[model samples]
Target: MSNGWNHTAKIESLSFECGFCNNKVASDIGFFNNNNIDGLRARIRICPHCSKPTFFLGSKKLPDISPGNDVKSVPEEVHALYQEARNCISISAYTASVLISRKLLMNIAVSQGAKENLRFIEYVDFLAENGFVPPNGRGWVDHIRKKGNEATHEISLMDRDDATELVTFSEMLLKFIFEFPASVPALPSA
Candidate 1:
């Protein structure tokens, strides 16, 4: 008998990408929680590569990290780095995300005509001094710089809130510098 739903009577092995290891493989289902009234099934699947458990609520993964905001008309290289930072958050790599957010500041500055090989702080300053950083955005840009420096120099790990804030700020900065400017139609040369 075939039911309209995609649920199977019994699931032995499931194929999924391990969030921790980012590997696609089939692994044995460790256990399942079934709710008869709601027909909801929660499964814990073990990742063979990382030996970690991923929680799935009826095939929907838990801890579904937000993918961050999307800005159009971004340069290809900058877009790639921005996506990398965003993807790091999805894998719970908060520290990596924070670091990438910091690097993005440098990239943005250079893309906006700032000189290369400048000190990290200089990049932040260039953005602010040249009117690249949005008004009232210098604070959060500094936050990204400080947190990123701590992640690099100290023995501390970045939390979700820190990563989210930096990534969000980076998105806004990119929009301000790239997307928003590209959005306007260029005036015809006289």
Candidate 2:
């Protein structure tokens, strides 16, 4: 899961469906040192998560985000961006999906009365601090933060699975922030 020495990539982990085997798994990446070139452009080596000898660039995007099912009953502004994110995921545009999901989270924060003019990372913290998202949810939301950063700032592509995870997390977050609360009634005074 790393480019060889003289390469600048740390890689770490990449989750995707193998184009060859059509199985979803986190594929480990490593540089293929042919001609001893140290650049990543020529070093895109794919590892089969399965023991089978198959090379895959990546698999088609799964329909992970659904506007009709996933975003139904969600608030309007948030739902619009969330649907966009989901649409991106369906088309294998993980980068765009992530960016839209990030925006969705921001919209959720604002809808829930979080202060305006804060950065995206701050919104995550605000959600946790304000009890909009429980403490345990912070870690996964932070994962979205990382993915959002990569999607916005890096040239390297992200996997559909990664964006899917972010969308799923966003769906949960939206439910916690909006749908669940709306369905629940306020308690009467004793």
Candidate 3:
């Protein structure tokens, strides 16, 4: 009944198609749990048509939920970068998102003691080398980074196309970080 994630569900107000029955059914049963280390887990019965089972687990945490494992599972710097990248995209600030993505990539590189030089192409290359991004994504990263540079320097205006691209890149970066946090090495001393 409890998996450790906070959730609120009203059984009477819930209705969904049953996956198993392939028919509409009222959601009469609700289960909610708040997972402290991760996020929320909820299970609800929608219809007899689909009266199977539903599970939802929010957030990813270290295996076993141990404090030390959790700490070692995801670096704070990487999480911060993810948050900033998400914020920039949510606000439709594509240029800002691109810049922040660059910073995140750079931070990962520096943490691994890799090259610290700041260049669009180099940034993509570093991301690829560190396995934080797909090898073919280099071109896309370079494109966004260049676009961000022009906008930041006032050489070009932030356009919808650029903004959309930046958002996509941010999303991809966030997914990568979530899947492979260890790939982002620790940052070097400033």
**Candidate that scores best on TM-score:** 1
61-106 per-residue lDDT for model 2 (tens digits): 3332243236446778888888788778655787888888777778
How does model 1 score by TM-score? 0.70
Q: Which ten residues in a row have the lowest lDDT in candidate 1?
A: 1-10
What are the lDDT figures for the candidates, one per model? 0.81, 0.68, 0.54
Q: Native-vs-model 2 lDDT?
A: 0.68
TM-score of every candidate relative to the true structure: 0.70, 0.62, 0.45
Rate residue 161 of model 3 by lDDT.
58
Sort order, TM-score high to low: 1, 2, 3
Candidate 2 has a TM-score of: 0.62
RMSD of each: 9.3, 11.9, 13.9
Lowest-sum lDDT 10-residue window in model 3: 61-70
Candidate 1 Cα errors over 4 Å, as ranges? 1-63, 188-190
User: Once model 2 is optimally superposed onto the true structure by TM-score, how far is the C-alpha of residue 6 displaced, in angstroms?
Assistant: 52
lDDT of 3 by residue, 1-190 (tens): 3545334455444444443444555665655554333345344443445446444234221111111011233357865764565455444455665666567666765555567666646766766777766657777667766776777677555644565556566556655555466567889999
Ranking by lDDT: 1, 2, 3
